[model samples]
Target: MTSTLGFAILAVLARGDRTGYDLATAMRRPIGYFWTAGHSQIHAELQKLRSADLVGFESEHGPGPQGRKVYHLTDAGMRALRDWVTEPPRERPERDELVLKTYASWLAEPDLIREMFADQLAAHEARLAEYEHHEASFDEPPAFGDPRFGNYATLRCGLSYERHRADWCRWMLAQLGRSGERPIGR
Candidate 1:
């Protein structure tokens, strides 16, 4: 079975052939599970995908000491990606630390909790602003077949999430203010 990282690599190649460095940089972006990966993990996945016959690379002369390899999806890789795109994704369990903290927050000091939520609200608003600015750059949404369409689509979801999260943070702060006594935990 192909791993998600394997598919992430293929997706980047689907846009165009890229060196491993390019693929690593692309993975550090607007969406997806690969963001936490370092360059070594990305390079390892590329080799695994190559071994699985999903990707092929060409040796190139470059300034780097070992030179570079430009990777592209094979026909099988393209076909696999097309099939995977339509299939329902395997859902990973949601493990949100903030929500967990909120559940346990009644034990903490209300002032400190308010400070934390306020910081969180600010962060969400900042991210929302950045995504909105990027969305505004396009005259309209890119058409579905265009590679940019995927980027635009993911960005829309991010904007919505940030808005909701910021709203929730505000609500939490308001609820905390309604109480006269401080919470128990620090």
Candidate 2:
């Protein structure tokens, strides 16, 4: 079966053909914001898609990509991508390290936990600021069917998620300060 990464490769190809290097650049930008895959992982997935008959490629003839493959979606790949687009996404298991830390935080000093959350909040805020700048750069959202529409929509979601995370961190900080939270003795 084609993996989710395979579909990601196909999705990129749907926009247009690209060499592995170009695809890596695209992945690092908007897609990397969500679905992260390393350069090697993307290449491996491309090979898998080729084996599955989901993608095709021509010999690349660019500077970096000299003699490399410029991959493109096959008809079957397009059909599979369209079908996957509408189907509900599978639920990924929640494995956030900070959330896990939060679960066991009572075992650590409250101040240390506060520091961690503070750092997290700052990171989230920084990303939020960048996303905001990007959103402002767009004169308007792309109309549906534009590939840019996908980028805009995902940025909006990232905005919401960052705000929510920052708010939660603030709440945690407040609780840490009040009532003089004490860590449980080991």
Q: Could you give candidate 2's per-residue lDDT for residues 83-157 as a string of tens digits?
A: 999999889898889889988888988889889999999999999998899899899999999999988998898
The CA lDDT at 39 in model 2 is 94
lDDT of 1 at 107: 86
Local accuracy by lDDT, each model = 0.86, 0.88
Provide the TM-score for each candidate, comma-separated.
0.91, 0.93
Off by over 4 Å in 2: 64-66, 181-183
lDDT of 1 by residue, 90-136 (tens): 99898999999999988887888999999999999998898899889
Model 1 residue runs over 4 Å out of place are: 32-36, 183-186
Q: Candidate 1: lDDT over CA atoms?
A: 0.86
Give the total clashing residue pairs for model 1.
2
**lDDT of model 2, residue 72:** 89
Worst 10 residues of 2 by lDDT: 60-69
Itemize residue pairs with steric clashes in candidate 2: none
Number of the top TM-score candidate: 2
lDDT of 2: 0.88
Best model number under lDDT = 2
